[model samples]
Target: MNYSKKIFCQPLLWVIALFLISSGCQPKTEEQATAENRETDTESKLEPLTTENVVEVLTSYEKEHADSLVLISTRHGDIKLRLYSETPLHRANFVRLTKAGFYDQGEFYRVVKGFAVQGGDSDTRTMKNGAYKIPQEFNPKYIHKRGALAMARYGDERNPEKESSSHNFYIVQGEPKTVQELRAFEAKHNMKYTPQQIKLYTTIGGEPSLDQEYTVFGEVIEGMDVVDKISEEQVDGQNWPHTIVPHKIKTINQ
Candidate 1:
């Protein structure tokens, strides 16, 4: 064999061997390829909810995630809530966002003493406004009592249809409404108060004026004290708390 040819062939063999070894190191196993395919499929399937598809998407989402119970944990205390199935769209939207890590990124930013504690739209969060809105799922039975969970929305001047905010929400820490006050609200809003509503407004107390104005989707079942504490936080001119109350919202079942 010619020494020149032998030398050249030796280096070429080594280079080919090295290339094969490097390529073989990253062997894509069957399980690994399957997992990657599944991940890609899931990502492709999840589309954004828009005004045209919000109702349809949420209606489908509701069937799978019938989760109603959610827990909001803050440094002050944990607020346990029971989402109402009556408001399916609102409940499903909330559950979806909670799973998508939406509320985990925000805080109880707006605290209005004796009125409500607004959250799920903190300045710290990136989702300043929702991409889509849920239709007003106003159930007359759901009054804005203390600890009642309701969706926040823009004013009627701009939003005549009264669509609910997809992310922002408030828990009522309302003061007691006198019978005279309830009557005044009914007359002004053309609303009628039931015996149970009047009793709750007078006794346990709530923002009676908010009845039917916003969609009440849930209620604080176990942590009214925490709700009260959050509401009483010292706030600024914009109702944002001086010391922000960061929160992590989670579904109890999920």
Candidate 2:
């Protein structure tokens, strides 16, 4: 009777051990499954926003929503800008950069009183790094008028072909210049502004001479006061602000 009991107990123990091993090797717990599903969902959502996928997204965006207006929020004030559909490259580039947090923690490095407040250098993007350069997309039709957002570039002698620097951009703040002033600028650059362009300038108040010279991709939409504050800050010889009023730019919700 003792041997018979031992035999039965031995088979039962083996059966229990096999069951434990099988359960251990089965699918993960509900908590673990949920966590894995969440991770996958996050990755899938971020895939479209990644740098690799940005270009395609921007290209499609340009065709359907060229007249989209963007609002830039700053600590000091909000600035609104209308994106130009004509300059698809510049518009797309600006959108891509903004979404990537490229303007976070950036300083208004150059501020000319009653003229413009400039920022967006790679240096402004981060304390430790400088920004990358972008190709020039100058449309003579897009002029530098009050509140106009324009790219800053090195002089043609240095930049040759008037290519724009991707990192630096400025928002015009001064009163619009007259046609005579625009003509003088055109003469200096050996270019001409068209009649249609002149009409646009007369109505819109842009510096036509600056068209095709600098890339005008956007304009100030909301926070001119914040720009004024930065423009009015005291600065050193190197254009570094003595007081260093920090600024950040965020995209407006559509």
Candidate 3:
């Protein structure tokens, strides 16, 4: 009877020892799961604050407001501009700047005969002055035509490539349309225009050569006469008027 009892007790002791070993292993498993869960939570918390996420948000905003329009009031007159949906970056940049009242005190700094009128320099935004710059957004589809508004950049002399200044832009007016004139302009600039584009320029009249070279995000919608008036202004060597003409633009609904 004593031997049977000892045998039973020995097997029960082994079982108890195995149970303790298994219990100890379970704590490691639980610790590992807890660590993995913590890592997952940290990653989830860090996700949306990334730079890529911020840029995505801004890009989304630009897409939403692509077709917005703004009205430009000048001492000459008022011109309504329809911001193009195709050129999302340029459209959003312009809208953002205008809403910030960046152009409130800006003057038309550069004007040229039969070419364009330019403004939006940092020097233009002044109590005395305010300064800011935007990125260039050059789109080939939008051309410089009658009432076509585009950004102005320094000539390729220093820039070498026609890189645009974000703040400065121009309005193209009554430039003559001739094949020879087109050829001469293209040849002089070492640029090329498509046959269909050339045909459009000759008939419809535009600075087609300027397409894709500068950011053209908007066109004069209502007050093209105002653009014409400003385009016709007299200018000095710097392309600035002897009298400073103040131009103010306010954005309305698209």
Candidate 4:
């Protein structure tokens, strides 16, 4: 036997046998492989958000995203909103969407004069129906005063838990209510009005009926005028504006 040929052939056989063993020994299921890929590749794909993962994802997102102010630009004017830090989930979600350009060129689709200027139903980037709904972050300190920024939600009939919509929001253009009116509302709704709510509703004018029903997460630090203009836009009987009130939301100081 030739010793050189034997050595080379032995090494080649070992290399081929090792390759087969390595490939066959480790078995990964589809889910395991996908999970590993998602873990390794964090830059490209986001984990699919569901009821189970929403909290974890948002919690992780909140640590990095510290944006507390957003600007909604429109033809009418720019509406600057100061997001409340108390409502961390809502604040973080808004910041995330704004950073993702989810509200770009969106219309104030529903403008109920003297009530609110509801938007975030952008023609381009509207969240699909049955999307993630956030838990209610109701604080007695926050009320539906004029220019109050709040999340819209389904009625208590379906949304008894009062979860807020993921994207749809409104800026109140509340019609002033009197002390007596507020008292009546309190009696009818079985909700007590806070001193702060009473004072703001009486002085600045706001829809007191919305108190405790919706999550007021922020307020208009500037551009109430723009909100007023949007609310006054002409609408058909369905509350939809005849013309589009396009808007773009951007995160600032993130």
TM-score (all chains, Cα) for each model:
0.78, 0.63, 0.64, 0.77
Query: Which pairs of residues clash in candidate 3, taking residues 3 or more apart in a chain or in different chains?
Result: 125-130, 126-129
Rank all candidate structures by their lDDT, best first, as comma-separated numbers.
1, 4, 3, 2
RMSD of each: 21.4, 23.9, 28.2, 20.9
lDDT of each: 0.72, 0.55, 0.56, 0.69
Displacement of residue 32 (Cα, Å) in model 3 is 54
Error of 3 at 29 (Å): 60
Q: Please give the range of 10 consecutive residues that has the lowest summed lDDT in model 3.
A: 1-10
lDDT of 1 by residue, 1-254 (tens): 11111100111111232222222112223344334435444433234455678899899999999999999999989999999999999999999888887788777765667777777754344432224668999888899888899888755654578787667788888878899999998897787889988999999998877777788999999998998888778865445578878999999973
Q: Write the per-residue lDDT of candidate 3 for residues 1-254, one digit (tens) a residue.
A: 01111100111111233222211111112234334435444333122122124335436768676547888888888888888877665676566557656567566765665656666643323221111223456665566677787766533343445544434566766454899888887776466777876776787586655655566778887887776677677865444577776777677965
Candidate order by TM-score, decreasing, is 1, 4, 3, 2
Task: Please name the candidate that would achieve the greatest TM-score relative to the true structure.
Answer: 1
Model 1: residue 108 alpha-carbon error in angstroms: 0.7
lDDT tens digits by residue: candidate 4, 1-254: 11111100111111233222222112223355345445544432233354456677778888898788899999999998999889888888888777766577356876777777778764443232223567889987888899999887654555688877766788888777889999998887678887877888988898777777788999999999999888788976445688888888998764
Name the better of 3 and 4 by lDDT: 4
- What TM-score quantifies how close candidate 4 is to the native fold? 0.77
Clashes of 2: 12
The per-residue C-alpha lDDT of model 4 at residue 137 equals 93
User: Which stretches of candidate 4 lie above 4 Å from their native place?
Assistant: 1-48, 126-130, 188-191
